[model samples]
Target chain A: MDNQYIEEAYKEGFTVRFAVKKRLFSEQSEFQKVEIVESTHHGKMLFNDGAAMVSERDEAIYHEMIAHVPLLVHPNPQKVLVIGGGDGGTAREVLRHDSVKECVMVEIDSSVVEGSREFIPKTSCVFTNPRLRLTIGDGVAFMAETKEKFDVILVDSTDPVGPAQPLFGPEFYGNVFRCLNDNGIVVAQGETPFYEPEAQRSLVGIMGKFFAVVRPYNFTNMTYPGGLWSFIFASKGLDPIRDVRVGAEQKLGDFFYYNPDIHRASFSLPTFMRKNLSGLLRDK
Target chain B: MDNQYIEEAYKEGFTVRFAVKKRLFSEQSEFQKVEIVESTHHGKMLFNDGAAMVSERDEAIYHEMIAHVPLLVHPNPQKVLVIGGGDGGTAREVLRHDSVKECVMVEIDSSVVEGSREFIPKTSCVFTNPRLRLTIGDGVAFMAETKEKFDVILVDSTDPVGPAQPLFGPEFYGNVFRCLNDNGIVVAQGETPFYEPEAQRSLVGIMGKFFAVVRPYNFTNMTYPGGLWSFIFASKGLDPIRDVRVGAEQKLGDFFYYNPDIHRASFSLPTFMRKNLSGLLRDK
Candidate 1:
């Protein structure tokens, strides 16, 4: 069979093309279209509704960043909640922290979990860890009804479209705020600033109304549309920078991206982003 | 007419496509292939040998970073040299500092200058400035023969292939060291760490032999191959982070990306880059 090229058009004019060695599996799940392909550039990759989600080569940067930053901020995060991370990458990083006694992952689509578990084992291997409890259900519905609180809640959903649309609005953030401890922190993927500044502004503005400290940090994701991606960090009372323990990153054995220096430096936004998100970011 | 899309494959497996509204100009220059196209996503873009050089939409991030960081690190950069920035974007930024008495820009290709001057005048408009003296010649030859010393040198060459290959070797750096003052600094485009770790390690390793302080910092360039790009900072006796004047960025009236926080944050490389470049970086 001839090698195929998969092109993802980010917008009208820009696109990224990945050469695939083979298409392992493809299915139209209830939530979205889940795909698994062996790519020459990115290793085995998983896609949700035609959007690249995780790949073996570059998943560490996105996973390590989302999990380590907030885990380092909270003094002792014994309990954690992860929403919509069916690929198990987020759960893998969350379980890395020894302080966490239990990690509850509620992913809406069972196909993503099943596909990732078999296709992308590097990230999905953590699904079998003893500390993890997997639940196949809607993340938004679970957030609204859960009486339990978490020290850190990671909202690792797809783009703010289709099933992930509610995750970016005020209702979801209000429920997230209600279910967090006084010193809790929630970090969510806030889209790319280059192409989605308006989405970022609205996300930050909604979170700022609920959390005392809301700041967006940056990381480079090659598979994403604009190369640069942001994660919104919202807290009840603790600051992501000041509250972080100095030597906490050493505890995470080997990280591809996140470190103590990077944890702090990631908060520095470019002047353009800072200007566009002026009133939304609550640094204090 | 149907919209034409131009695709540049960074490697065998990865590529980026840009939608072109019209082909403004195309020619085979003496040094390389010079092309200008009006892009829907990037505004007017200049491509050299099929590689995207600078886009009007995102030129500020790359140009401001290459110019302002070293300028702020040195106490007073009176005389500066820029090599291979034929688009004049680098000189536009270099002239922003009022302390710059003379800015010498040496570009090997006149076609690039002429085409950019006509099609992308937003950046090429700086060629009319009195402080900048444009020279058309081989940058390696100019560095080897220049009798005058500069307070700062900016090597804004293309990729390590083609006619720009000589700019990345040890000989060019040796001459750059010889032409710098006691506290002079040199910042060179050191390729992206994601796709060119070997090039980065080699560049940092070579500069380590010449300067007391040699470090590589990163910035995100979406037009580039891997979304992430790096610039190597080398100095005779100055530390880029500590020697930078506090609040000096205020003097530069308005900037799109360069700031004091960004200047400090850019040096914090990821864990993988740090491990790969372990002994090559001389922080002291």
Candidate 2:
């Protein structure tokens, strides 16, 4: 196998390389440098500033967990908001629900969506769906100004080290809290506890202040940094484990990961993570 | 960074590379190639047959989860048997319990143990523990021929791809059933479910025949192929989740990953995994 393009992903003191068969597209987006590369093994992959975002092969794991988990918890989510999921995989998953009438995705950069359509055409088709409202602006500003409330808010941002750092902050969460309905649920793709311990601990702590019930869920994402990725869900009325609607899996279409059993199981954090987040949760 | 050794581990479809600072020891054991190399970030690392066995940095996560989960489930495990944990980490964790009087370790390769003592001294200190009786012999033969019955039987072998394949077979499971007491529990280091789905499903199916309770638990191991790894517990009298001893975490020393909450949570398989395993469990 003669591979030309190679992206070296450095995380948690190790280097993992994904061999790209061909570079499909590259652009200096306003938010970051967005690149889409075709790979032999992982299929078409989208990278933001040299970091992996979504791949055609395993993006379903990330997308399904982020979208369906919070969706299933809320009884009837009519309106939903997605922050920073430019590749449209998050929006695709959100629209799968029969009750969700409107899904507004606020992506900072338009080039990522453009690249996704041009290179990774399969998952990107949802961007053109009439039910999806694609907004090209700052998610923070959109959440603050828009009076339209959502039943669920999904943050599909990148890692917190760079431009997506603000998305994980309390202010952003506060804005999300305001934009959501009174009994709404919000979930973000939290970084892995194994790789980013402090970040994961702090994120749960920040969300606990604004919401009555804040819980973090985990899933196995092979393309991600440590393969153990998490999504932090904070709800006003619904408990993620208790409020999950029975027979929700029946309404959902061909999913690679998310199910009712997985929804309940995701909240069972390891001892180290429970120790890291419990004190933070109890501080309030 | 000037490095002497670099190992590229290929698993599933991804490649992870670890940089080694120095080679501490090397020997061709009768069973496999035993090599201990000092890594810059991971501390001392052990490799068997060009595959990672354990690393000093995160060996606690693997060792603790493997040994303590089954140990805590059983009320009072007096006699324990370890099959193929040559690194001595399993022996160290089993001896932590005050109730366990003896832990017998049977490793086929003496050179693996010899290399561990010479290189990874911290985790390998249990080789000298008085309660542990080390036996260097074929584990399969020992289980078949020996009349000794153990309260807890732990299989801590390598990947099921090569020499370790036989250890996961139905015949070996039969030997384990014969060597265990009437109310005994057997736990094996099952392969990563995320990487090897068929193998994991088959192992569960095979174990279902011999044991009334066969459940798989998961943990995150950074150095492993997939960060998520599994340990399958097969028992005759005790249910891993229902019979887990309370205050088990307090009884043990400071642990990096395993705990009572995690012990219960680990059995909560992912949706795809539950779908894979439930079918196998339902077969019997």
lDDT of 1: 0.91
lDDT of 1 by residue, B176-261 (tens): 99999999999999898888899889989999989999988888877887788899999998898988999888978998887889
Q: Which structure among the candidates has the greatest lDDT?
A: 1
Report per-prediction Cα RMSD to one decimal.
1.5, 2.4
Candidate 1 at residue A122, lDDT? 94
The candidate that achieves the highest DockQ relative to the unseen native structure: 1
Q: Write candidate 2's Cα lDDT for A159-242 as tens digits.
A: 996678888898888888887888899998889887788999889888887888888888877677667788998888688877
Give the TM-score between model 2's chain B and the true chain B: 0.95
Q: How far is candidate 2 from the true structure (C-alpha RMSD, Å)?
A: 2.4
For each candidate, the alpha-carbon lDDT, in order, equals 0.91, 0.83
